[model samples]
Structure formats: structure tokens, C-alpha cells
Target: MAELLRNYVAGKWIAGNGEGTLLTDPVTGEALARVSSDGLDLRAAFDYTRTSGGAALRGFTYAARAAQLSEVAKLLQAQRDDYYAISLANSGTTKNDSAVDIDGGIFTLSYYAKLGATLGDVHALRDGTPANLSRDQSFTSQHVLTPTRGLALFINAFNFPSWGLWEKAAPALLSGVPVIVKPATATAWLAQRMVADVVNAGILPAGALSVICGSSAGLLDQIETFDVVSFTGSAKTAAKLRAHPAFVARGARLNVEADSLNSAVLAADAEPGTAAFDLFIKEVVREMTVKSGQKCTAIRRAFVPKDHLGAAADALVARLSAVSVGNPRNESVRMGSLVSREQYDAVRAGIASLREEARLAFDGSQVRLVDADPAVAACIAPHLFVIDDASHAVRVHDVEVFGPVATLCGYEVATGNSRLEEAQAVELARRGQGSLVASVYSNDDTRLARIALELADTHGRVHAISPSVAQSHTGHGNVMPMSLHGGPGRAGGGEELGGLRALNFYHRRAAIQGPAASIDALTESTGKVEI
Candidate 1:
């Protein structure tokens, strides 16, 4: 029997009371650990954070809170190798994939730390300068962002456990909001372990951060109007969370980063052998194989010029063919298994759904494993579906396989008469409802600019790449702290990162109109001691 992973309640690490649920190793199909959060005092946990955690964090200035984050980042980075080893067993991700999550989390912490430190010591962030409202300038109106008087509930998905938790926590904590993290049950061990490390380091204040590793029963019921909830998962789950009575009726804050059917396009003017075309193929292949295409930002569809579809397909086949799939523990393996057998089955179901409107461009059932047995390992080869008549392929747009899978759609270029105009490409991209990102590969300055603008409303981020800038481009799926990373409709209309803007999720903005002395007293702008 695997040892039970304990949940951190209040300030203590306590073993779950229920017969724990088993967590399996993806590559070997063996039990790795057991997780549970039964027989826990749900109300007490929330209250502990609300009182102890929130109070302690509220005591610090923004810069002091950020400085604490820097300490946590340094502690985690020193032990990153341990996280890498653990991820190899549970996630079946290579060192590179683990670094993207583990290292990326540290980087995010540091980024937010620096951002907050630069703001100096302040209890509240003042928005712009106070405006003069009175004719004599005695009265003015000012806007300020202040931390919510409650805790933050972060419910993250199975993939990128460490990164998901840290990315949300960094901002929430900096905003002086305590956090209660509920990681997806399957990969909660990593999150639990990371929290345990932070606790052991004695960096964060008591009850400032907690992780519960089991069902979220009664969890949503505990949230109130002042609390903020940030979720990362499927669209369906995002909707359910958004509809929670506490959020829907009480008006609690909710920021959801759901999986989107993001797309990448090849410039209509690019020839088959051009650098732009080659970069497109490389980007797709990388997204497909990395973490076995489990990233929320992974490309789910590729748009190519009709005349160049065959060439693009051929190039993709060559690149994907060379990818070696096996246990992530093997140095030779390039791609590895899905997180677990359950996730493997889910991806299989998604693939079956895709077959209704598209043919298999790259067969996945048949593949060679480098250092593992295909019969027992929870692994699937990269899959490519070709949309023969994209105009009517509703399933291709509506369905997302959420694994190493994508649909290829063709849009004809101008040859005296352009079969598919840039407007049509934008229309095809919008069929996804909304997405986290959409990338355009084009050399035509006019066409790319129009496509980018048209896509701006539909996607959280728009990435444009050509041979001229492709060399320096950050690739199609990369998310930066300086940019907004959420979109509308199906992708969940929430925003994150974006520098100081991210702090908005954990803050309340209010406008005050009053005399200058009163305004100065409320915001402490007159230097009568900061709030």
C-alpha cells in the first residue's frame, strides 16, 4: 500500500481520515501514493485563513509581501531537482516539461515579487492622481485598489500543478489575500508537497497558504461575497464554478482559465519550403509532444493555405515522426504518457468524437515506444485530423481532444483570385467561440495586422510570426507575465498576469469623492501614517 498524502489544514499537516484514493504512475501503471481530505473541519479551515492568515498578510506593506514571495521562490528553486524527479513519476513528463512548470512557477514568483517591490510600501494602491472636482480644487475624486477582506480559493487542474498554484498564489498573496488551494485529486501530491516545503521553510505566515487534497465537497458552500476564486480546468467545470450560489448570488470574484481550442495559422503567401512554414511545423510539433499535449495553451488546430496543405502535412509528419514516446525517465524519450489511465481514456473519447467530422491525418494507435511497453503504459501517439470540408465541420471547431491532437483546416490563398481571404481565416478562427490565444503566420504586413485585430476580441492573446520576426518570436503558446492571459466565451472571460492588472482580481476598486483633507485621511496621502 502506498503511503497516504496528508492535507494541510489550518497550520497542521494531518492525515486524511478516509481510506485514501490511490494515485498511479502514468508510465508504469503502478500505485504511487494515496490522497484524501476526509474528516476535516471545513469551516474551521476557512475561518483559520480568514482570521489568522488574512490578518497576518494585511499587516505587511505591498513591498514586504513581495519580499516574502522572493524568499519562497529562492527556497523552491534550490529544491527544484526534487520536484523534477517527482514529476517524472507522477506526470510522466521529461525534465524539460517539469522545468516549464516547476521553474516557471519560480520565475513567476520572482516576476511578481519584483513588480510589487517596485510599487514601494503601501497598504493600498492608488490609481492615477486624485482629480480636482471642486472649482477651487478643494475637493477631488480618487480611485484606489485594496485587498479583499477575505480569502482566495484556487482550484487548479491536473496538469501543471506547481505552476498553476504559484501563478495564482503569487498575485493573491501580494494583494494580501490568504489562499486555500484545492488541487485536482490526481496530481494533488505535487501541490501538497510544494506547500509542505513552503510551510517547512517558515516563510509564509501561519494559515496564509493551505492545500486540501481530495473532493471539494462543501468547499464552494463556504465561499462568500468577499472571497476570490480562481480556477483552471475544462469549460464545463469552469461554468459549474461560475454558477456556484456563493459566486452567482453573493457576487464573489471568479477568474477561470479553461482549456481553449487555440489555433495556429500558416501565412497564405509562405511557400512550402519557406522559414515561416518550417517554423509553423516546429511550433505545432513542440506543442503536441510537450507534456503529451496537456498544456491549456497547446495548439488544438492548424490552419494552412489550401495549395500548401499537402506540404504542411508532410512537414508535420516528418517532425512528429521523429518524436520518441516512452517513459519520461528514459533520456531518449521525447514524449511520454498522459497523466493517468483515467486521463488516457478521456483523451481517447475526445479522439472518437473528432472522427465524426475529420479523417485521421496522423494515425495514433500505431506507434513505437522507446523504453516502455505500449500494452500497459498509458501513452498515445500524436494524432492529426484533417478537415476535408472545413466550411461545414462544426465538430472540428466544437470538439477539443485536449491531448496530443489537432485538426488541420485549409484556406486557399490568392492566385489572381484568393479562394480564402483574411476575413474568412478570422471567421474560421472565431468558430472556437473564444480562446486563450490565436497565432497568425504571415509576411503580408496589411493582412497580418487586420487578422491580429480581428482576432483580438476572440482571443486573450494574439501572436503573429513571419520569417523576419519568427527567429525572435516567443513561439505560439507561450504566456508572459506582462501580457493578459485569458479570453472570452468558451475560453472563460477572465484576465491574469498583465503586470499590476493581475492584482485587480484580488482587490476591490472604489472611487472616493470628498474634500482633500478627508481624501488624504482615507488614503493616507497626506502622510498621516499609511493604512
Candidate 2:
């Protein structure tokens, strides 16, 4: 029997009442742990966060909260080796992949800490120039960002157990809002250990951070009007969460980052064998197999000109062929298995559905494993499918396989009778309804400007790759804390990160109408003392 993982509720590390759901390793199919939040009191958790946790954080200035984050990061980083070992055994990611989550998570804390420290000892951040309420400028109004006097409820996805928690938690904690993290049950142990590390370190105040490793039963019902909920998962779950009575009736804010069909385009002028075409292929292959293509921001669609479509397909297929899949512990393994057999089955079903409109350029679901049992391992090969008809293949655009799968759409360079415009690229990219990010590879400045401007309304981030930025360019699937992440329509119409802008989600904006001299007490800057 595996150890039963405990949930940290209201400053207590407590176990569930009944037998819990078993968590197994993807590679070895061995029982690693059991997780449950059964019989936990949701009301106490909520009340503790509001009273004990919120009270501790609310008294601190922004700079003090930032200092806490820096300490927390140090504590987490010091124990990274232990976390990586757990990830290697259970999280179904390779060594480097685990670092991307564990190390990347600490980096988020550091990044936000630095951002917060620059604000000095301010309690509220002023918006813009104060508005003169009266003709003589005796009275004025100033908008400021203050911490929300409520808790943060986070529902994270399974793919990123650690990064998902910290990315949202860092901003909320820095802004003085306590956090309640509910990680997916499938990989709850990884998340549990991370919270346990912070709790054991004793850096954060009691009740400032808590983790519920099982079902969030009745928790959503406990949300108040002022609280914030940040969720990452499927669209179906997002819908159900949106309609929760507490959320709908009380006007609680919900932010979602759903898995949409993100697309990447190869420019028309960047023909076969060129650097642009080569970069597009390399990036597509990397995105398709990394974390076994479970990322919400992974490139699902690749648009190429009709003439170069064959060459692009051949290149991608060749790259996919060279990838080694099996147990991640194997020294030679280039790619690892899906998170579980259930995920493997889902990917198989998605690939079957995709085969209706697109033929497999490289099908490796039946490929032999390098260092693991094919029958027992959750190993599935990377697949590349191509749709010859780009304009009308709605299935490729609408449906996301959510695994190591991508569809190649052959698009036309000419629109109707004209051929010089770059609208064709944007048209093909927009078929995703809305996407988190789109990568456009072009050497021509005019085409880059044209496609980027056209796609701006649809995508949250448009990554235009030229030779200049390509060398140091972060790939298509990654998100930076300094950049704005989130998209319109199907991708979830909520923005999450944009330097200090992400802090706004955890903060409340107020317009105070008063004399400038009196407002100086609230804002950091000197406001008309002479008046």
C-alpha cells in the first residue's frame, strides 16, 4: 500500500477520512501514493484564510510581502533536488522537464519579488496622474491598486503540478492575498510536497498558503463576492465553474486558462530549406513531443503554403522519427510517456478522430519502447498528421488532441484573384477560434507587420520570428511572467500575466475623491502638499 498523502487545511496537516484514490507512476505502473481531501471542512478553511491568513498579510506592506516571497523561493530552491527525484518517479516528466517546473516556479517568485521591491514601502499603487475634480485643483481623484480583502482559490491542471501553483500564487501572495491550492488529483503528491516544503520552512505566516490534495467539495459554494478564483483546465470544466451559485450570484471573479488549439505559421516567402522554414519545423517538432505535448500552449496547427507543404511534412516527420520514447529514467530516452494510461487512451482516441480529416505523416503509437515494457508503460509515440485542405478543415482547427499530436494545414498564398497580401496567413491562424499564442516566421518586415496586426485581435501573444530575435527566442509553448498570457474566445478570455499588470487580478482598483493633500496618506507619491 502506498502512503496516503495529507492535505494542509487551516494550518493543520490532516489526512482524509476514507480510503483515497491511488496515484500510480506512468512509467513503472507502480502505486506511488494515495490522495484525498475527504471529510475536510470547507467552511473552516475559508474562514481561516479570511481571518488568520488575510489578517497577517493585510498588515504587511507590498515590500514586506515581497521579502517573504524571496525567502519562500530560497526555501523551495534549497530542496529542489528532492522535488526533482519525486517528479522523475511520478510526474511523468524527464529531468529537464522537471527543472522547467520546479526551477521555473522559483524563478516566478524571484521575478515577482523583484517587481514588488521596486515599489518601496507603498500600500497602494497609484494609477495615473490625479484628475483635478475642481477648476481650482483644490479637489482631485486618484485611482489606486490595493490588495483585495479576500482569499485566492486556485484550481490547477495535472500537466504542470508545481509551476501552475506557484505562477498564480506568487502574484496573489505578493499582493497580500492568501492562497488555497487544489491541484488535480492525478498528480497531487508533487503539489503536496511543494506546499509541505513551505510549511516546514515556516517562512510564510500560518494560513497564508494551504493545499487541498483531493476533491474541492463544497468549496466553490463558500466563495464570497470579493474572492478571486484562478482556474486552468478544459473548457467543459471551466463552464461548470462559471455557473457555480456562489460565483454567479455573488459576482466572484473567475480567470481561466483553457487548452485551445494554438497554431504556428510558416511565412509564404520563407520557402523550403530557408532558415525561417527550418526554424518553424524545429519548433513544431519540439512542441509536439515536449511533456508528450500535454501543454495547453503547444502548437497544434502548422500552416504552410501549398507548394512547400510536402517538404514541411517530410521534415517534421523525419524529426519525429528520431525521437526516443520510454521510461524517462533511461539515459537515451528523448521523450517520455503520457501522465497515465487514461491520458494515453484519450490521446489514442483523439488521434483516431483526427485521422478522419488528416492522414498520419508519422504514426508511432505502436513503436517499440527503448527501456520499458510496452504493455505496461504509458508510452505513446509522437505523431504528425497533415491536412491537405487547409481552408476548409475545421476539425483540425476546432479539435485539440491534447497529446503529442499536431496537424499540418496547406494554405493558399493567393486570396481570390490577388496574391500580394498577407491575409491568408492570418485567415488560417484565426481558424482556432481564439488561441493563446501564434508564431509567425518571416524575414520580410512588411509581412511581419501585416500578419501580426491582423492576428492581434484573435491571439493574446503573437511571436514573430526573424533572424534577429530567433537566436535568443523562447519557443512557442513557453510563457514569460513579463508578458501578457491568455487569449480571446475559446482560449479563455482572461489575461493573467503582464509584469505588474498581473498584480491587478489580486488587487482592487478604487477612485478616491478628496483633496490632494489628504490623499497623500494613501498613495506613496507626494500629492500637492502646497494645496
Candidate 3:
């Protein structure tokens, strides 16, 4: 029997009342651990966090909370090697992939720590300059931002267990809000260990940070109106959460990041052997292979000039063919298995759905493994499809195959009319309804700018890659803490991680209308104010 993973609740680590779900190694199909939250008193957990945790966090200034975050980052850094080992065994991620989640989590915490230090010793933030409310200027209205009097409940996805937990926790903690994380059960070991380490270190207040490793049953029922919920998962699940009574009836705050069919386009101006064309091909391959295309921002659609569609497909195939897939422990393997057999089967089914609408350009289903058995290993090779005409292929735009799969679509380019080509590309990209990001590759400054502007409304981010910034530009799928990471419409109309902008989600805004001196005193005082 595998060890049962304990849930950290109400300031103590406790085991569930029932036999838990078993977690396994994807590459070897070996049982690693078990997780369960059965029979835990969630009502008491919520009360403790709201009172003891919320009060402890709100008692500190932004700088003090920032110091705590810095300490947490240091602690994680010291144990990063352990985290890497766990990621390899359980998540089946290579060193590079592990870094994206483990190291990325620490980096985000450190970034927010430094950002919080600059906020000085204030517990409240002024929204803007005070406005005079009376003719004599004796009275004024000052908008203020303060932490909500409740905790933040995070329901993270399975793809990024470590990073997803910390990314949301960093902001909420810095904003003086408590956090209770419910990581996806498929890969919850890393998250549970990280929380246990932090709690045991006593770096954070008791109940300030908690984790429930198994079922999310009755978790939403514990939420009150003042509490906020942030989720990252499928759109179908997000819809169910939105309709929950906590949000629908009581008006609880909810932030969702759902399915996004991000795109990458090679502009008409970037002809066959140019730097822009080469860069486009390189980026698409990187996005598709990284984390086995499990990232929400991965490029699902690749658009190219109609004349160069075959050339683009050939370049992608040649590059993808060189990638080795197997167990992460194998040094020669470049790609690893999915998180589980369930995910592997889901990806294969998704590939079949895409094949119905597009022709298979490169079949990776038959690739040889590096150091793993085909029967048990959940490894999959990269697959590339080409859609001759995207206008009628409904699945090409609608379906998001969350795996190492990408479809190549062509946009017609009219002779001597670059605007028409740009417009058509935008139209094709917009078919996603909304997306996390869209990368437009073009050396032409005007064309890049025009397309980027047109794509801004439909995408949370527009990554315009030119020759000048080719070396400096980060990959399209990489979500940086300094930029926005959510999308609108079908992609979940939520926002996150725009520097200090993320703090707004955990804060409550109010306008204080009073005498000028009183307003000034309220804004300038470092003392805590009642929420």
C-alpha cells in the first residue's frame, strides 16, 4: 500500500477517513502515493482560515508580508532538488520541464516579494489622486484598496501543479489574503510537499496556507461572499463552478482560466528562407514539444502563407522527427509521458477528432521510445496536421487537443495587397473566439503592428516577433509574471499576472468621502483599517 498523502487543514496535518485515490508514475505505471480529503471538516477549516489566518496576514504591512514571501522562496530554493526528483517520478517531466514549474513558482514568489517591498509599510493602497468634492476644496473623495476580509480558494489544474499553486498564492499572500489550495488530484504530490515544507518551517501563519489533496467535495460550500475563488481547468468544469451557489446566489468572486486555442502566424512578408520564417517554425516546434503541449497557451493553430504551407509543414516535420520520447529519467529522452494513462487516452481521442477535419501531415503515433515499455508508458510523439482550407474546418478552430499536436492552416495572400493577407489572418485567428495569446511573425514593422492591434481584442496577449527582438523575445506559450495571462469569451473572461495588477483581484476597493484632512490621514496612515 502506498503512503496516504495528508491534508493540511485548520493548522494540523490529518489523514482522510477513507482509502484514498492512488497516484502513479506515468512512465512506469508504478504507484507513488495516495490522496484523500474524505470526512475532513471543511466548515471548521474555512472558519479557522478566515479568522486566525486572515487576521494574522492582515495584521502585517505589505512589506512585512513581502518578507514572508521572500523567506518562502528561499525555503523552496533550498529544497529544489527534492522537488525536481518528485516531478520526474510523478509528473514525468524532464529537467527543463520541471524547471518551468518548480523554478517558475519560486521565481514568481520572488518577483512579487520584491514588488511588495516597493509598496512601503502601508496596509492600504490609494487607487488614484484624491478628487475635490466641494467647491471650497474642504471635502474630497479618495478611492482606497485594501485586502478582503476573507481567504482565497485556488483550484489549480494538473498541468502545472507547483507553479499554478504559487502563482496564485504569491499575489494573495502579498495582498494580505489567506490561501487554501486545492490542486488537481492527478498530480498533487509536489503541491502537497511544497505546502507541508512551508507549514513545517513556520514561515507562514497557521491556516494562512493550507492544502486539501483529494476530492474537492463540499469545498465550494464553505465559501462566503467576501471570499474569492480562482480556478484553472476545462471550460466545462469552469461552467459548473460558475453556476455553483457560492458564486451564483451569494455573489462570491470567481476568476477562471479555461481552454484556450492559442495561435501562431507566419506573415506573408516572411518568405521561405528569411529569419522570420525560420523563427516561426522554431517557435511552433518549441511550443508543441514543451510539457508535451500541455500548456494552456501552447500554439494549437499554425497559420502560414497559402503558397508556403507545404514548406512550413515540411520544416516542422523534420524538426519534430528528431525529438525523443520516453521516461524523464532517461538522459536521451527529449519528451516524457503525459501525467497519466487517462490523459494519454484523452490526447489520442482528441487527435482522432482533429484528424476528421484535417489531413495528417506527420504521424508521430508510431515513434520508438527511448527507455520505456510501450504497454505501460503514456508517452506520445508530436503530431502535425494540415488544413487546406480553414474557413470550413470547424474542428480546426473549435477543438483544442491538449497534447503534442498542432494543425497547419493557410491564409490566402492577394498579390500586392498585404492588407488583405493581414485581414484574412486576423479573421482566421479570431475564429478561436478568444485566446490566451497569438504570435505574429513578421520583419515588417507596420504589418506586425497592424495585426497585433487587430488581435488585441480577441487575445490576452499579442506576441509580435521581429528580427530585432528575435533573440530577446520569450516563447509565445511562456506566461511571464509581468504580462496578462487570461482571455475572453470561450477562453474564460478572466485576468491575472500583470505585475501589480494581480493584487487587485484579492483586494476590495472603496471610496472614502470626507474632509480633505481626514482623507489625507486615512491614505497616509500605516495603521490597519477595518475592512
Error of 2 at 342 (Å): 0.9
- The lDDT values for all models are 0.85, 0.85, 0.92
Q: Tens-digit lDDT track for model 1 on 1-531?
A: 899998887888888887788888888888889988888898999999999999999899898999999999999999898898788888888888888889888999999999888767778877767889989999999787788999999989998889999989999999899999999888877888899999999999999999999888889899988998888888888888878898889998899888699989787776777777787888988888888999889999888877787888888887878888888888888888889888889999999999888888788788888777776788899998887557687887888887899888887554556534655567788999999999887766666777788889899999988778866887677677778889999998989888778888888887889899877775553111111
Q: Which candidate, 1 or 3, has the higher TM-score?
A: 3
The TM-score-based order of candidates, best leading, equals: 3, 2, 1
Which candidate should be chosen as best, given TM-score against the real structure?
Answer: 3
Candidate 3 error regions (>4 Å): 414-420, 526-531
Q: Which candidate has the highest lDDT of all?
A: 3
TM-score between model 1 and native: 0.96
TM-score of 2: 0.97
Question: lDDT for model 3, on a 0 to 1 scale?
Answer: 0.92
- Between 1 and 2, whose TM-score is larger? 2
**C-alpha RMSD of each candidate structure in angstroms:** 2.5, 2.5, 1.9
lDDT of 2 by residue, 1-531 (tens): 889999998889899878788899899899999988888888998899988999899778888899999998999889999998888778678887887778888898899999878767766677776789999988988777778989999999988888899999999998889999999988888889999989888888899999998787788988998899999998888989999986779988899888688888888888987888888999999999888898888999998888988999999988888998888998788888888889888998999898888899898866778888877888888888988877777678778988899998888787665634556667878878888999888777667777887888999998888766778998888888888889988888878877887888988887899987866666544211110
Off by over 4 Å in 1: 414-420, 520-531
Weakest ten-residue segment in model 1 by summed lDDT: 522-531
How far does residue 313 in candidate 3 sit from its true spot (Å)? 0.5
